[model samples]
Target chain A: MQREVMFAGFGGQGILLIGNILAHTAMEEGYEVAWVPSYGPEMRGGTAYCLVVISDRPIGSPIIRNPMHLVAMNHPSLEKFAPMVKPNGVVVINSSLIHIGSDRDDVDELLVPANDIANDLGSIKVANIVALGAFVARSKIVDFEVLRKCVQEQFSSKEKLIPINMAALEEGKKVAQIK
Target chain B: MGKILMKGNEAIGEAAIRAGCLNYFAYPITPQSEVAEYLSRRMPEVGGVFLQAESEIAVGNMLFGAAGCGARVFTTSSSPGISLMSEAISYISSAQLPVVFVNIVRGGPGLGGILPSQADYFQATKGGGHGDYRLLVMAPASIQEAVEMVMTAFPLAEKYRNPVMILGDGLIGQMMEPVEFPEHLRTEPSNKDDWATNGMDTRKSSKPNLVKTLFLNAEKLEEHNVILKAKYDRMKREEVRYEPYNTDTDYQALIVSFGTMSRVCRTVIDDLKAEGFETAMIRPQTLFPFPEEPIKQAALKESCKVIISIELNMGQMVEDVERSVQGGRPVHWYGKAGGDVPTPEEIIDVIKSFVS
Candidate 1:
């Protein structure tokens, strides 16, 4: 099975970072993955996005026009990409930033207050990881434990911030389970 | 080795190092500046040289200077920057230096969008620079293939003593994929003492090796052109590489595409197969040699009626497709320019129109 995941937000929201984490997690699980970021002349606060594609077999095209799922961190990202998601795919909306839902009922829409969760964990920088945790927990695209390992490995060089980020991930996963 | 995710540009840099090419001189340009960015940090760790030149012109000349000293050297640039390096490319080719150039192509006649486009098909396969010279050009569809091609390009360039280009689109540069760099492809420049100006003392040779392109006399220049022509002809004979997809099927149309454009067409072919419209594609890995014979043979199949050249540009490769077909099949063109790559659905529609 092949799946495409889009993660989008204002630039510097770590949209591409979360997307990369997801792609790396998929790779760790023995899936072929491609992470394509919207690049060049992109400015801070402007719309920055990335597409992560995972497949059992080799991926033919990484430039996917319509992804199966979306983790939209802002309103524009949700509004623009929600309509393109395939039926029955998960659409994660950052409820902290985006107030509205996916509008269409064909897909499973989970609203997680990712920023608030990260804020409670003491920093807003981990918000992207929180959203990623919520998306992975809701979709089960990959095993959660593997994701945990990947996230820790991502910040292995930093060392001190892993516990807070892990807390933020847990909070996000909790919201996904409840909602 | 375990698989690790890498952007194509960064992967290209590492691949070059793996191929024993340690000298990199380049002027950064989108969407390929990441190659320089990655190499700048990684090179020092490997005890390699990485210099950001003042401009692409200087970068090209730097490559010439390094390669003449028998160093495996390369540079990466986008469209306009490549154009700036064209003159140097011609000079280097005439001097018969083994050098690698990568054009992670952005759209344009002049500073076009910073998105993927294969508009440089003519610039690459044909002569982008001037005079009688051709770069041995290869187009890779995936990140793994990009690594392999970059590794292989060094040896091929050294073998032919000519400039080789890794022609990728912006998507190939920007996209990140899991790549396992091959262990066996690493190679140092061979037979460098034969022609390289790497000090007669270093080689303990009596013959003074002078690398120059200034053949001002008519007969000498004509003789030099003949030698270059023979090298290109030899490459065409020995180095043509392509992948034929679903050619065994009784397909009615043949799709000739390369780079990321070929990836989209691969999906289109699969989807069409599901929908009961059989189509075949020949993805050209070597654009310089053009895979002319293969296209001709594929087009001559009894079931194939039309040969379509799908590119990201406004029909640049289509000309080569038509020439390859040689009037045996009706060759058609489908494409978009300056990025906005044609979707699989769009390509499917185009093929359906071609067949139906």
Candidate 2:
């Protein structure tokens, strides 16, 4: 079982962080994982993206032109990557920032107000964690408990921010369930 | 051992550390700059030396300096920057230094774009620098292979007492993959007492050890080249690596590819198999040795009618394929240069036309 996912947004939107968390969770679960981020001059304030591939076997190619899942955090990301999602794949879009919705009928689309959920949870910066929670709840690609552990491990050094991010993830899962 | 999800550049750095490379010197170049960046952070943690040299030339020279001291050393650079390092590479090869250099290739004959390209095949295998010297060029198709190759390169260099090169393009340098660290990290051999310029002890006879490539005598230079040739001969016999895919069947065409191009070729071959066309691929893992024996044997098969050489460059490895086939079969070349990687469809189209 090989799944290719891309998390895309502006540099500060924590797209890379989300990809890293997913990759780490997959690794912890004893799966082969690859997390590749876009570098070069395109990574400053411009649209930053990372490709994560989780597989039961060794990954052959880490560069993916058409990913199975796309988590779009902004309008530009939604516009750019929504159409590239594979048929029968899933797309989780942030409704608070993405102005347009995907028109494809072949794939599943989940539009969550991740930013609103994070803000409601008292930290707008946890929007990415919210998106991560929504992705986990809807797709079940990885266990939620494993993902939470990965989150804690990622933010373990920063003891204070852990609770807020955990709250943000729970809030995201709740909103995603209702939507 | 445990698995780690690492970026390609970072894996290379970590592999070097595990391979007992205690010194790394490099200058920043796109797509490959992360190698130095990763080393800068991780080297100090491992009690190794990581120096960001002012220029690629200086970095190459610094490698020479460290290797001259009989320390395990390495450097990383991209295409144009690698070109700047050619002079020092020649010197290192002529002097028979045991060091590793990584060329995370980008596009072009000039300051090309920061994208993956295999166009450096000629520059790498055909002696980019002056003189008749050869580097043991290894091309890795995956990030895991990239890490493994860097780990293996140090020992190979030490065994042959010559420079070894990890020739990867931008994709391999930028892609991420899961890698397991080697089980045992062997301590690098301490040859300093015999070869280095450390001050002599009074217990030993008074003699200075000077490492230089300047053998002004013509006959002596000829002897040096002959010794270099012998080392390369032994490497060709022992170190040639190639992977054969679906070669058991009667293939209408055989595809030769390497690095990332070989991965794309595998996808193309799978598509062709679904469409009822029998095709196979021969991937050269080591570029310098050329894996000529296997390629020649495959080409000589009566069932294999056409041989196609696919690359990211415009037929750089084609020359080697032609020599391997020895005109027994028609060897075709298909590629896109200047940082453009040929898609699976593009490669399949070329193969379809050739088979027809």
Best by lDDT: 1
For each candidate, the alpha-carbon lDDT, in order, equals 0.92, 0.87
DockQ result, candidate 1: 0.79
Over the stretch B1-356, how does candidate 1's per-residue lDDT look in tens digits?
98999999999999999888889999988899899999999999988999999999999888888898889999999999999999999999999999999999998989889989999989998888988899999999999999999998998999999999999988999999999987764555878998899898889999999999998899998999999999999999999999999999999999999999999999899998998989999999999888999999999999998999999989988898888989998899999996788889989989889877
Question: Looking at model 1, what is the TM-score of chain A?
Answer: 0.97
DockQ of 2: 0.52
Worst 10 residues of 1 chain B by lDDT: B181-190
As for candidate 1, its clashing pairs are none
Q: What is the lDDT of residue B356 in candidate 1?
A: 77
Scanning candidate 2 chain B in windows of ten residues, the lowest lDDT window is: B196-205
> Please, what are the lDDT tens digits per residue for candidate 2 over residues A1-179?
78988899888989999999999998889888878777655847789888888989766555667899989998888889988899988799899988788888998888888888888888789999999998888888899999999899889999999999998888767766875
* Candidate 1 residue lDDT tens string, A79-102: 999999999999999999999999
> On a 0 to 100 scale, what is the lDDT of residue A169 in model 1?
81
